[model samples]
Target: MSDIGPESAAGKRTLRRALLATRNGLTADDVRESAVALAARTLALPEVAGARTVAAYVSVGAEPGTLALLDALRARGVRVLLPALLPDNDLDWGEYAGEGSLARVRHGGRTALSEPAGERLGPDAVTGADVVLLPGLAVDGRGLRLGRGGGSYDRVLARLERAGTRPALLVLLYDGEVVAHVPGEPHDRPVDAVVTPSGTRRFR
Candidate 1:
């Protein structure tokens, strides 16, 4: 991993590269197995179990998979909201009906993403969620998350704060991504908990 800490943009970029490299090393089978375990563990969380609506994203590439959990939540009659990336990099949400309800979307030159094909719910739709699942490379003991530096979720967090919404914020990760510390900024907000394949950890 790069020697750069997580504070500076360069440092965060370095950390993100290192983390992506690590994730890239995992095989397809390994990711599937981990995804199953992650879903089981995440489903057991009280917050998730009690949530009637969840704001989450689809996993592309080697990111900890959310398909199983998303389906499970939907089966339980929970309203699942999936994000659609806007041209400006902000996210617009749509309801997740099922695997068939998602469409492959390519934003600019970036990798194609699986987004909801249903009605556009607008960005503020996230504020109505009981739980929000954030995508991250790593999270510290203090619950600070190291994202991919896209600034999309940053905007989501900011919007939630401005609306005075206090939904339970959670991140799904592999066990190895739980580090002792990560870079933090004034706009960076700490998550309420993290769910890994092994278990879930909460922070104050």
Candidate 2:
């Protein structure tokens, strides 16, 4: 195993502090607006624009922002899917048309907005996707992603890799969540892009 020591604890604390500071400095309205703007910028990316379908995760806890982005994607006539976490913490994709279109659903400690009519793509869904906006707990300059202590995304993305897919996996975060380096396990995944409040950066 990696160090998993005080540095890790300290890094997590720094991340928490950063999130708190961001929240404290910005009102709810500001965060919402910034999220919308950032979403718009993401859609402008060639990878995002060309994607026929995209899967994104619903924001939970103190995660930066995503609601407005979901709405923006829907407004643009894009097919958007949110993760439906299964009992084993495996993920299934479901369409999201907005809060109204979503039915209340939760599993594996993860809350989900589900669309019964939404098509459930196979594990190959990752390979078929034109772009994927990944969710993570933290990210670094090299695009390494630290998920919520779960190996789900890594496993899924690994499936895509074996099948030889090039879907752009992009990590979304708040402004300062992008760090110089972060502790990464061997199974941790790296994203192709990172989208922040200010802009979208191509790292892969």
- TM-score for each model: 0.95, 0.80
lDDT agreement with native, every candidate = 0.92, 0.71
lDDT per residue (tens digit) for residues 11-104 in model 1: 6777889899999999999899999999999888888899999999999999999999999999999999999999888999999999999999
User: Highest TM-score, which number?
Assistant: 1
lDDT of 2 by residue, 83-105 (tens): 66655657777677777765566
Question: What lDDT score is found at residue 160 in candidate 1?
Answer: 98
For model 1, what is the C-alpha lDDT against the true structure? 0.92
Worst 10 residues of 2 by lDDT: 108-117
